[model samples]
Target: MSWTVDEVMTRQVVTVRPATPYKELVALMSRHAIGALPVVDLVDSDGRLVGMVSGTDLLAKERAAAGARRASRARAEQAKAHAETAGELMTSPVVTARAGDALARAARIMHRARVRHLPVVDATGRLVGILSRGDLLKPYLRSDESIRHEVATEVLGRLMDLPPDAVEVSVDEGLVTLRGELETSSAGDVAVRLASAVEGVVGVRNRLGYRLDASDPRMPPLPGARGLPAAEWGR
Candidate 1:
């Protein structure tokens, strides 16, 4: 499925000014549970996404601050050293992604770039929103497919290392119903194994609780495949 960076991007961004005090940056990250933030020039620039800083970078600064505080140097020297300029540590020219790109492509770019987050930019290169690995992971982990067939095929192919066409599959996410007739009854267990492997799959309500009636269809009297007795199954 296609997704605009804006569609999935985190717009309510937390940011810091280049001159922000070290203690305040630490507080922002801890309180918000955010891994990183955009470092802008002025508080109100709200322009293009510029430099960025991550928790790791902040921790390094914290360590330096602590070391400086503990140094036997003059008290006034320690205070002067404690103040840090954001430009020294911040990564510049924020890595970005286009809003119109496919979700999978976005993820691939992030992986190749080794960046946890990417700012979304428009054609003119102005910051519109920000995309993070967390945003992409959210949809994948919460995926809710509506067809048991689709879910079974996809999940089985992934877990069992089997081709999609090799297995019969069906699924209904709403009501969480799963029903399908496997070519081999033993494969029923295999199907359940596959379903459980998906990140979003909570539980498998397999109607396949019991095995199918494996009957011979070569008999001349039988119409075709035999399930129940003709009367019970309604010929």
Candidate 2:
């Protein structure tokens, strides 16, 4: 079974507009206890996501403001320190995820970008929800019995095109063990791969046997076909 971002995302996401004042952003974050907020298009009722303002971003401005009092201001920090609005402080061209996207896809983006939160958008880039690392991990908490059922009925039965009872499936914690006879060695390999893709499956152990020995080498050339020397052939 596969999980999508919408399945675990927070539907009621706190958001802000570009022109929202910096202090207001801080207050909103403090009240909601969220690390970040998606900045939406104020002119449009659709609330399309355009940027993200994070707690770190707010703190950067504070740090820059402090540094300015002690010495000559660096150009970028000077600009940030004087910034008074969310648009001025936010990171534009935001990293975001789609609501229908696979859970793994969203997690990968967050990991690569080193962001804790991701705004879930629609096809038109409208904000629909928000996803956090914690939301992505909710599926792993599913009961092992649920995972085993999907592997047995969905992976082995429907996906592998084998009899429902052909393979004996056992689950311990989150590991899946597959043991049975398959038509070919490749079939067993396919089963293991499919089982691994199922949500909440930590690992897969393939104990399946195959009817065909695909690994066996072909027969060697016959003695006469070796094309030996004339004397050896005569002997």
Candidate 3:
């Protein structure tokens, strides 16, 4: 369940140098069908990432050339229009993700930064690979059969301490339907939440019934109730 950025990232990344020309940058992006390139200092044997230039960054030049009138001129955009080298146009202090970082962490960084691509780096900040939104979703491609087995054995049998056959798990195109009877209502909710957390699960339909309302203050708390919160259980 601990998916790392390197697990799904594109290893053969196309990088650029500080002195790379504008025309070459465009040609590289077009040839590779990529939206961004990590700018590196290639003086050393191992290229060290210094910045990044994206399609939007390249388009800024064109937008400036168009002379689109606005209330205030964006000096940076105007300067980029005349930039001839990667160093002059690239964005510095680039937002990046480490190769060993959790895919969820990388996804969060990408979402918060509003970026489509993430340049994955090594401990020393050397560019190693690239991660995209599409790559982060690779786990969702797991087969329904695999998901069912995990849910029955791992989620229900091991975690819930239920008999393997206690829960009837049905998976169809990543939609999971969990039907079973549990000793406590909270356990039923935990089952639904845990099944939903399984990788490749798009949605969970809780068809489970409970014999006892464990939520009642007079009743004793169910076993494993103190182990994890509902939201953090599957994570």
**Which has the greatest lDDT?**
3
Deviation of model 2 at 50, angstroms: 2.3
Off by over 4 Å in 2: 1-4, 68-76, 103-108, 136-140, 168-170, 177-193, 204-235
Give the candidate order by descending TM-score: 3, 2, 1
Considering summed lDDT, which 10 consecutive residues are worst modelled in model 1? 219-228
Clashes of each: 8, 0, 0
Winner on TM-score (2 vs 3): 3
lDDT (tens digit, per residue) of candidate 1 on 6-36: 6578878887777776677778889998888
Model with the higher lDDT, candidate 1 or 3: 3
The whole-model C-alpha lDDT of candidate 2 against the native structure comes to 0.84
> Each prediction's TM-score against the native?
0.52, 0.68, 0.70
Higher-ranked by TM-score: 1 or 3: 3
**Predicted candidate 2 versus true structure: per-residue lDDT over 117-195, tens digit per residue:** 9999988999899999899888987788988899989888886678877899999999999998986666676788888
- Model 3, residue 224: displacement in angstroms? 9.5
lDDT of 3 by residue, 48-99 (tens): 8988899988888878889853455487788898998999889988899998
Q: Over the full model, what C-alpha lDDT does candidate 1 score relative to the true structure?
A: 0.62
For model 2 the local lDDT of residue 124 reads: 91
